[model samples]
Target: MSSLCLLALNHSAQADEAPLTLPTGTISAPALDTQDISLQTPTSAGSRLGLSALETPASTESLSGERIRQRGDRSVQDAVSRSTGISRTGTPGDGGTSLSARGFTGQGSVMQLYDGNRLYSGMGTVTFPVDTWSVERLDVLRGPASVLYGEGATGAVVNVIPKKPFTGEIENHLRLGYGSYDSQQQALDSGGSLNDTLSYRLSLNRLRSNGWIDRGDSTSDFISAALRWQATDDLAFTLAHDYGDQQPMNYFGTPLVNGRFHEGLRDKNYNIGNDKQHYNDQWTRLTSEWQLSDSVSASNELYYLKAQRRWQNAENYNWDTAGQQLLRSGNFAIKHQQEQVGDRQTFTFKHSLFGLDSQTLTGVDYNRIRFQLNSNSPFNDALPDGQPLDLQHPDKGRFDSASAYRAQFQSTTKQMSVFAENRTQLSERWSLVTGIRRDYVQVDRDDLVDGSQSDKTLTGNNWKAGLVFALTPDTSFYGQYATSTDGVGGLISLSPSQQQYDLARARQSEIGLKQVFWDQRGEWTLAAYHIVKKKLLTDDPGNPTLKQQVGQQSSRGLEASLELQLPHAWQLQANAAIVKAQYDDFEEQVDNQFVSRSGNRPVDVPRRTANLWLNKAVTDKLRAGAGVRYVDARYADLANRNELPSYTVVDAVLSWKALRNTTFGLQLNNLFDRQYAQSQYNEGQQWILGEPRSFFVTADYTF
Candidate 1:
């Protein structure tokens, strides 16, 4: 179903272009899809200078909307999974968009953002399966980026760029699609200027489906809008808003039998009938820019985000061999309500620093977040004869009783940061890049269970330096060392004792080569890195009441990627990575005694990963594409007791230009119907089944 949205992306795509007029009043951004999809000649991923990807010293990649739509991606995960080294680490629903990268995973390491604003779930919460229809481009920076974004990005940062109002002739797009699992999709995009001083953009999408699992149904809608005002030649203002209401796939996961999957029960769901799970979010932002002078510029942004989530279901399950039945033990009803408000001010200038050509960016940011959670389990009876429900025939209504929580908890986080980065040209062929950031974080939590409270305040600093040398006009070599930090208890809450725990710290060093080959249409990057993470929290062996922060983790790895624009309108892209990650010095209290877990690999982290994709225009009217994704085996738990075997999936797409503005297409996912778990936890005892082979057809029109 992914590629169907691209049915009309032929040579005559000018009618679909959506150019955005910038707040700077004099600048405009052409539809990114019209540019080279691979090189991304202009981007803000690694630098605010608008440097080409080839010049950005970091390992960064950007994919245009056209490229993502061509692959028929529906969610943020869909687009990220195609990138090399990035492995899906959790379900898309629940904002469970955890990703494994570099040598770490989760919210404390890998970060995700909407636009340039960090979704700071601080407590491992991520925004839900954000529909791709609202994304204009995705930029990924695969290493420490704390200098740009404050804290917690030792692994990587994924920035989702949304569609903004652009100055252009009126253009609109409509797409309709249907797929396996009884899925339906409809989307609309409209953007243009009302006049020379005012322009607007709006995107809307509606989706529904009966999921792959029995009785698993889902419905979702997303809407985004932006209004831009070019009040004068020196200043401008813009406002944006986003809303999402979702009922994601109801299937939690299937339980394993005898420590292994049972193929016959693959389509079964353990949730109760009439169960409920839903998420809703609303966001608003205001931004303004002023060109104070030719050598100076300033900008400011303010935003607010609110979200609510609910879950009611029979969430945990396992097979009872002796009883010859399916054992379900947990019924949970939980709710989360969170809100965030923030502001940022930035100043940039171009000048001669110490007689060297230099470009500088300095910014200050402040953010405040309020979060709360409530839950209740009404049934103390583990098995009202439902303990071992008959596997052959589960009572459709046996576990239908609703849940009620006895209490509610509250938490709040406040943070402020000041950061500065300068790029100085040391010479015609050499450049120096340096930046630093200092952050002050405060957190307060109320434990309703005991009517107790805990609060903590911490501060940390991060910095990075890099040296770049241009060996030739089309080739370059670079080396960099960067540092960052992780919260003592992730970003949300901290253990009572750890309230004083120093934030975990991390540092990484890397060397890489960036080159343009096969003329200007191709590029290749090779990089190697060593990273160390320390101050991991663990219980004190000598004193059970105390906690220690001596644990450490390390990883060394190599990554390579090649992108080529081949002859005859063909394009090829391939990337792969191999890493050796280990818990260098980790210990835990087992059976009231300390036990070593020094050599185990981090859970859900694969040692190797790779992806390959190819697209060809067989004729001016037809286009075809194929891709393959591979992930090596990984541990599901910290003890390494359970292993999730490796898997490879194949996907294909074919599209036809049926008319001047209309296109039709078909997409096949998991072409071989591969049976594999996307990821696993709970000691590999529970399996999150991967999507099965599915098909979809789509039609698109422009007006």
Candidate 2:
């Protein structure tokens, strides 16, 4: 009983399976599989099946769901700007929307996850914004994964997998879109299967845009759901949920030579007259899974999120004896509230010992977070003869202001891990895979403003070892070593007595190569890594200096990726990243530097990056795609003498399947409207222009 009536009696016994006819030797096939039939597909077991740009031993990238619905990407930073060692910093008024893997920038050491839990606000420092149609796949795990996730991955780990529900029948989809400074979007998806152990899925999304500069505007909405249950034949159970909302539009900073790239003086009335900024966000999640038997299985998850923001600016005066030109106004308010509750329990086991082939994973996790921040400012200087100014009468009219600020913080994190994995075949050509993991972490932090409060605590231990080798059967080679830790933040901007800096450690080493050719339609990967970070938390200058932490730094890297599936329905992919970061000793602000020798290349890092996509399937109801992206020069501060010039962008897509579960799509983004500047300061400038070439025409149906 219950569990949806035993999943409707296992979906009416699988709809009473009928139609069957097969005689003549009763089909005994697969004898021509002499060459091992490409190791029997399914990615030769090890259940980590490709995608994420053809997953290798490490360094990953993926954006599928039909290439994110043919590239009309609306958020999640437009699918992480099409990968390649990602970079997007301090979006939304100087401290939100940060991601900088490899050279590690914001959110400390990059780590954001969903579906596998951990979604920010555990006092690991802030950075949260996700609502890309509830993402259905986007895993980019490169470098440190903190031994099964814990601490801020010293520069990598972003998983957003969501979208599950399939068994038999019932499927639906709907999408609508519009473009250019008056954008609009709508999406909906559904799933079925209510018997034989049940199945379900639901998704909804909405987005609106009116931006191209000048107080850029935006709106977002989302909802997601999933469920699955099976009571026997080895057992099963699952549940999931997510919700979202956002309102963005607050492009600040102007001055950089009057904000280039004309668009009616970047939205007329110039002179910083019409200034207004806003923010509102919400999030939620819950999950559960179990199959406790026949080798064992278990999982559990829960999450919650909230946010708020507001700002305004306007002030100027000239009057020149009433000749006109005077407008003054000011108001600023920011209130952020966040709460998080976490849980993760995992247990897995498999068989075969002496003959090798084994698997064992054990986990325990607990997290608690509470946050609050409030700020306010109001200013007015009266005129119109209502009288207010006259503070020794140096100018003529009104002047009055008020201010208020508040802060509260709390955090608790606990994690324990133990894992074991092994696979040994050593004969039929040879096979060997090994794994080990050990982790333990505990952290606590509490900081409440004025009322005088401060507390901090930390403990850590991490380790990981890996090895995989398979010569034939599609190739394989792997090597890994890991260790990670990072924490300590009280709103970083430096100088608040450098916030008692401490806690930072990282050590990583990787070697990889994996390949699957022809039969599987082509795939290639290559990786090389070297990382060393110890107590590295720089920026300290006498008397607390607003919190600072430092103790050495080192990073070395090389990555390569390629994907090809040509011969009719063509497609090609590419990725390349290189890093060499320094400063492993010596400190005297710039006088005793041990490295960094002013060779800046770690701030919004970019040494070289590339992307190319081409797809074609002319007939069978049209299909076309084109793409190009490149980056090289970057460094807009960190004392690299300002530089951010190196840009290339192009994109195109057209898809049609006229009928049979219908589909029609058209998209063109940044098709040659380039003009870059993704960050800058010294008054203001943060442009990465070229969003004008947008066109969307989508129609999808499945049932």
Candidate 3:
């Protein structure tokens, strides 16, 4: 064992003054076990012990609905920003947010699940909107989870669990808010049980704002409803539907020397445009539990998800040649549409074999996705004479006249996976968890633009093993190793005639410690991990402007987090991470030097990051909180020459419960009005001014 691992075990032993004890009965019955509740830990359905976050062998984080509401968070982005080893990469044209965990960006690298159903598998667009009103809790599982989820889970998995039906009286909450820059928001949530077996919940939200930038406006609308039916004590059915539409400002790249900060907005004469984005998603699930005998039981879950999205935008640029400045506009438009429909089923059987205790879990999942894209553009050049043209019919000057080209690409992907996991207690203080998974993938692409067709198929096998040792009643230490794979197709080629690339493989190993102190009111965790990805995909350096994927990269890192519930109704939370990601054993076309020898940092990845938050209750009905975030400087490209400056941002909030069932809250984002860029590709003329110190005041009434 490594010295670091020994240190972790030693610490665990020191924290737990009491000896570990095992329960006598089966682990499934929760009423029989006693343990402290820590939001950072995972609860075992069988162990009955409500394990504190410090007791779980793996790295996990939880955001309770109450905590979310207190933060005045409007979206998942707002909630995830506080977690460790997490970041958001804004999408182009559309204001869609994609999550990055550890050192890997979105795609299959990070798994997104809604109610146990895989939501992002083969999904064309990387962004999804989840209604906060319907969320019961958000669980984050860090590190590789491919053994249970099957390929594409190299970094972590985020599970959004929805609220369940209540058996008692009906509940309702309505909120309205108005803020800076003419921003307005309204939301409503209501839920009730219809009968002994049926219950439902509905949520609605709307927001509009005349943004800080010129001609930059945003409008959003969302609606979601859920129904739960418990036909029997062991059988349950759930159905859900969600829809949303958004129109927000879109900005492209600008010259560095542009003295004026346009905030990514185009000048009136630039004739640039923004985008209109739309989304709709729905799902249904059925779960059944059966008790065959005293020591044996069975459970199964079936689920399906359907999602679709569309996006439509025009950009402007200035070209200077030979001391002559020429203004040009690119009237680019793309009709991108995608649909994902899939089903997943899992079954688990619990029993004791011989003198050993174990439960075998088996599952199969299948998913299909249809994606299509149509793109066209027209270019117009301005005259050197600086003549004002007609608004409806602009003149095509000395440069190339209006040129139009369109292409239609369609693709379909199907994936099926089978997995099994078993947990066994080797001794009173030691336990082992082992699992294996196999996945089959098939893809077909059709080029409507050229009548060309192509197909590809791939198969992958992944597994995981971990050992957990309970050093004391309140502390534990664990070490694990896992492997995962990601299919490479979307970024391979724009033309359907090209052959699909081989799957990329990622292997990760981690050791960590979890400990609880102060009667479970405080919890802390530290983990060290190394990940090596083979045939990893990245852009070609020689042709930076082209959209293509090259292979071979790796990343290694360490993460630490602490959550404390202090005296006097105060809470403090902090997370810090350091990562080093780079290309491995690969040579770029620009320079024949191997990437490993060059030692260039991965693009868009920061080496160090940290976040701290403090909250206090001023009175029985009043509360206040403050937070700050820091990100280290990072290289914009693999060469490591262009560096993005490091920055820190601060935020604060206050809330008052004026009445028994009424509350008022105020929030200040970007309290320092810091100007920073989230990613290297961000095109705004200036650093994406972090929301410009906006303020919002809201009133909420609950029944």
Candidate 4:
């Protein structure tokens, strides 16, 4: 349930003084209710037109920070997985923040944004905004999104809405926690009016853990602060800054022995003893909104971001059955430095179109990005066939690579886009919504090692049309068709071979029903969609050594969710999705031959997934909740030679209000001690083990 309203009023007065006159500007508040799961809440992720989830023609959902905390979701990825048709596909290389949705995997298909601004992936990786302490709510749009964003959003969009400042009485919050594996958490937040015309907010959080796996240590620190200034009755401005530093767990995955997982090896860390993985990010933005008139409004945002990341470790491992040992290779040291600057301006108007009530919006966006990469490539400086280590009694060695890292490549990208959206009421029971977007992208790449440079120019057009009909005052039926585009991987870090290919094109058709029943005590939604993507790069049949952009992939699926507030203080929420994802026309190179994989499922895609959560208030001061999640088996390779098994996990939480402004909680995760794999590496040769059973005790205080 989300309780963040789109419109709120604030008194522009100091604590010791009264306002000179009534203010006309509005202030948006964060979602503070843990039990308010209503689709009627307005969200920006689904449509820039300010449509609520129940009114949008696509599948959308919102999860509030308070709700996420009550459910014991510690990370952004874990919190997002609670939504429908979404799953985690994170790895060390991607900063453990990547996701898979709508049968599409990786950052290329599923785009991530912060405060409505995207932080482009450098090398198919995103490492910032992984912490949820600063998040107010998470908005998700689970379908073709290129019509709203730009290319590389063919699957879904996730927007992280940070907490903002509001003019009110002074308030502060503090939280502390201790959990299994020597894990600890500390967080603090404060916000209030600094003056009659200014309000501010600041948040700080730190997390540290000695992970379940041997030698697995991790730490993360984050700071977020903002200031809001009300310049006039109809105008306002806000400036915000955020910074993050992280050192993720060094363990990559456990090598499979003889093509099978061994429970005894699940806790082993296969990486070098002194493995290094770090990420640092900084973001700054200035936003302004002006209510020009009763029928017109304008808004603008300018933002800048800087990021640095580094990784050094043995990333891959394979079991040597003949020698009864493990082979470790793929050793490399890599670094990335990136900077981005962008601005967005939008104008909205309310008027009559063809004698009907209508609202329209027009916007322009421009961005420039610069990135540089440093790495040790080719692996020629390492021992051949990999260095062998004992399987049972291994000694984790230091990172002693003979090759030295050097500047490899640098890239500059300039992107420009123009978009528009319109919604009109055709009749008392019918409405229409339409949108269009055009994007121009230019990329220049320099091969520093070879002292050669090349550039490419690309253009993409996207559009969507949707129809909504009111079956009853409480139920609505909608249908839509949308088109999108996506790059092979990260556009800025395209390799020489990848740069030669064009972007892929995709289309989707969807229909859904939204209804609120049981006298507004229950709500349910159902949606069905089919998507097809073309121009995928695949092996050329005429020439096995070359590639052609003529392959195709498709997926069809059904998604459903239900939330009910029953009697006896019991509340229930459930969601399920079934997807049939496969390569429609494709070929893969295997054993020096082009093999047809037209009918096989894509790697790392689950066919079935479901979640169920139930909460009950035993008394006015005590509450308990339980949840269950299940994921179906998934193939790990193009040929479908290796399959990962299905798994189910359970979590429970209990909290008691000990004081007027304080609460204590006890949370237990993976109650059954289920041993499951979260992700795979090297074509199923290894599996990243999920966290084992753990428990935490926490205290939260507000003043």
Candidate 5:
């Protein structure tokens, strides 16, 4: 665990205004026996006060690893995009796999966190923590999370929490599986108490696949290990490390034939035979917590991260009707090497304020990131116009270059932040939660090709306030308002031209209701929110020849989720969201001229998304489950002229206990073999199709 928030809270019940003593004596680990009941579970990503999902006064979802496996979700993206108000917009191998939430899109808006620490993207790309095998749970907070995190989180924050060490009987878990397209998966997890005051946990996973498309083979490996020591009754320390190495599929997307899908070309691979994409990452963290007194506690975390990524391929393809060939462009080779170090310290106070119970938290965070890039752009090495191949049958030629890759750029980013949060019980039926955060960021860039340099310093201030009212012992209503910010582009890779603009600013207002009924058998939540963003760079309205930061965009949406455990050993889970997203004032440069895009929906921002899952226990050792997912149509370009059609897919799973400590399962994905675009590239000219019907057989054992 990278955060001390895992220390469970201890409330005083002597009186309504009794002082509370938040304890840090024992670690709080989630039980692996249950798959539901997230409403009552505490999440560190949602709040620093150790509040449960229902008490956070915001929309949060906690999906356990067991629940995800039962649903047959293999990738982190597959599990996270199923939550309310979220949809995928890119692929992991494309240097970045981004998402759209509320009204915001891309890596510059939605952030990713591993073990409660940010994975700073070098150039708008995040390629670590891709697999879900090592994850314990995923905590999602939707809409304007800058008050809890920091900048670049106007859309949402997805926290990937790995399994942690626990003091108990030694246990070991092993899983092996085989799926369609010659895919194989293997995983192992072991943990236990090594001594009276020490515990250790380790996880390993490997995956290999001969993908559904031609020449699309991929492999990945992940390892995580942790050790925990309780020095005294009031102090504890934990050290953890994670490593990942991946070689993702070399396929980009299929080019459209006459601006439409061609079923005949769905399985074609139109790139050099040696196309490559690789990512390697390492992360290490040490965390310590001390209970200074009954009413005071402190914790600190120190961490380091390193990442290396490389790509070489023909990324874009254009159809040539007359010539009966496909013209490929954007042929490039690029590399990124990044290193980061950071530390976070927090102090917590639990006492009475104005004769009411109050919990206050203050924290300071600092991190420095260094990044370097190497690439062969402008095609100075031959093949400047790109390669053309026959439409029907083509020779997959080898990658040929006359010169070696050259240094492109190197940059450094330093940031410091201070934040405070407080939760107070105003009365028996009402409470207030508020937080404030400020960040100072500095970015410096050097262009190796031209010997150009640029530097910029930015400051961001964020705050949020909310009120929660207990309508009943099992129901609550809440409302909140928050502010956030996003850089115009990836901060670490900011170019000289982009350094002239300030970070975009955004604000959001939300209201929600949560309830648990039917004797803990059912739970539901509903939320509605509106967000507005300004300072977007756009063409000057008076003079279309110039650009200015006077543009605006907004979105309003409603989201709902429900989970129920019915009679006769049946379970149901469902969620849906609808959004109205539009640009109030925006423009794009086309053919050296600016065109207004006001009132246009942002590209890849779907208006509606929904998911439903149902499971039944047929016998003491047998179970069955099925799920459905739907995504509405979306515009593929700012002009709103190209549209990607809506799609729906279904999946099913069955499991049987074959032994006392072993289980066998079968999973069928894309049950209907629905043919639809999962993502797009080259301004929607190319479409990455979704997987066809596939099946897998898996065995899981625990000892």
Candidate 6:
């Protein structure tokens, strides 16, 4: 979504000079992005009525590919976590980006989309740990998005858009870099026209590194290609495919020293030496667009996805100070193979009912997925080698190779939804938008633990209504109410009890103001929201063995963001968020007794977070940037007894242009080298440490 270029043209007329002629592929004058900090008008993550960000009546933002490359962010995590109101879990180089937003986390709270399509994965993990080099844009929509994306979005939704093809002369971009911990990076992008009506584009990326901790080495590869055919002036078709593979380090976690982190234990890896994780993913899609008329358009998108995942490691590690050794347990291994196919059809047209300008959008979507799981559930023992694990020095390949994987569960899910929306411009400054959707879902599960089969079905109807009023050419105020739900049948396997209950649902009301001031050089947005969720499952009062659907939760918060394209080629950006997430009414079993947790704050959700970044152009060809991020303390358990201290980190970057079309970049991360715990798990016995100071030098060339 981000790139930069500057174009200028001068013309002189003396009888036209015999109709001047230039290069074969050059025409008109150059009009491009003159600066790296300027924001682009987003086409997605909004009302779909072609409204600008100030008129969408929602909180939405986008980061472009050029911005990502300028900052030297290699992975999705590196690019996403720095955005306002966003946090992530998992260690570095783990091949996964688990994100949190609006004080919510996990599969039922957030949704991920690839090029405007859903992946429909709910296995507690995503196999595709994308590389930023292949991305064209990443869009974010905060709060509920089921109105446009179907079910399962409560906190937010992220959309990753890849590069497409264009009809022009061949173009190429290459990058090579070296960094801390013996890391290496290589990336390539090329695209051009094959004929008058055919065009193609390709992207490739690879990263390898010996990480900061012992046995922490990782490798990743990604490749994508697309073909576009301009069949006619009114119709076009696009076909694209992408493949990825990863062998990320299996550094589960470091052992906690006396319930706290110790400097001496920062570089330790307690897991068995043979531990590792790997995965492969593939995706293919086809799209068709037709300009039916000047006022009407239609489109269709179809896609198929395949993935295979594997994990093997001593997932749980504990420190035994008395014995002077580290004890490893919870030996785990599992495999998964999943496939999904889906199709979407949309139509946009103009309509009039009450003598006003009205726009209408209608769409239908359908998807199906088959998931299978295999595991060694009853792990024999952590010490399968029958030898005590030495704390200071240990041998490699101490794994249990005799274990076999057996089918644990199998599931098949199907969903279909239809949606329609209309926007009516009643006056020059006032507009109203309304939308509604209906979704039907079905789940079929086979329990391998017992010889049994179960089927579940659920239906949901959601709606949205909003109004926008413009006070000036660049200022607007808006308010909206929206509804969403969690899949009733669940995205993965469903139990017999889940088939008898309804799906949990939520609704939110929000108001906000958006303005672009300082002669269109600065933009600001602010919003406040209150949300309530109902029909969550909890233990029944009369029957201890049964469950009831009477649980509820609520979250109230405020968000603010500001960006300035200041004078002298200097830019500044900042954002902050504060929230209170509490259980409205719930009860759980504790020590053989059911207790109330009606006012407890949810675990893993922080109350405050903020970010600030500044960049400047020192001269015609030299630039520098710096940023800082602060994350407040977080409770690791529901009881609020285990707390992880807060921490702040800093980063900086410098770039110099040495040639006409080449640049050298040096990036420094965690400049202060402060140590902090990203998170704690396994009853506070394991800790994931944040990375230390690191730097990289990159050479980029364009042709």
lDDT of 2 at 671: 83
Single out the weakest 10-residue window by summed lDDT for candidate 6: 1-10
Give all TM-scores, in the order shown: 0.93, 0.29, 0.83, 0.95, 0.95, 0.91
Q: Decide which is better by lDDT, 3 or 5.
A: 5
Candidate 1 per-residue lDDT, tens place, 504-588, comes to 8899999999888777888999989999999988778888878789999999899999988899999899999999999998887
Total colliding residue pairs, candidate 6: 7
Q: Could you tell me the lDDT of residue 132 within candidate 4?
A: 84
Angstrom error of the Cα, residue 676, model 1: value is 0.8
Candidates in order have lDDT scores of 0.80, 0.55, 0.62, 0.86, 0.86, 0.76
Question: Which one wins by TM-score: 1 or 6?
Answer: 1
Off by over 4 Å in 5: 1-19, 23-34, 92-96, 322-324, 379-385, 400-404, 540-546
Model 5 agreement with the true structure over 97-162: per-residue lDDT tens digits? 688899788888888899899978877899878588888888899999898788899889999888
lDDT, model 4:
0.86
**Displacement of the residue 9 alpha carbon in candidate 6, Å:** 52
Q: Model 4, 1-703: lDDT tens per residue? A: 0000111111111223321222244634342334465777888898998887767888988888787888999888888888888888888888787787888888999999999999889998888795888888889998899989999887789998888887778789899999999999999988888887788889899999999988889999999999889887678899999999999888788889999999998788888877899999999999998878766788999999999999989888988889877888878789999999999999876655545566778899999999999998764436768888777666688675667789999999999999888777789888788888999989999999999998888889999889888888778899999999999868888887788888899999999999989999998999999999999989987887789999998999999999999999999989999999999999888777889999899888899989999999999999999999888888889999898898899999999999999999999999999999888888888898788999999999999
Clashes of each: 10, 24, 3, 2, 0, 7
Name the lDDT of candidate 2.
0.55
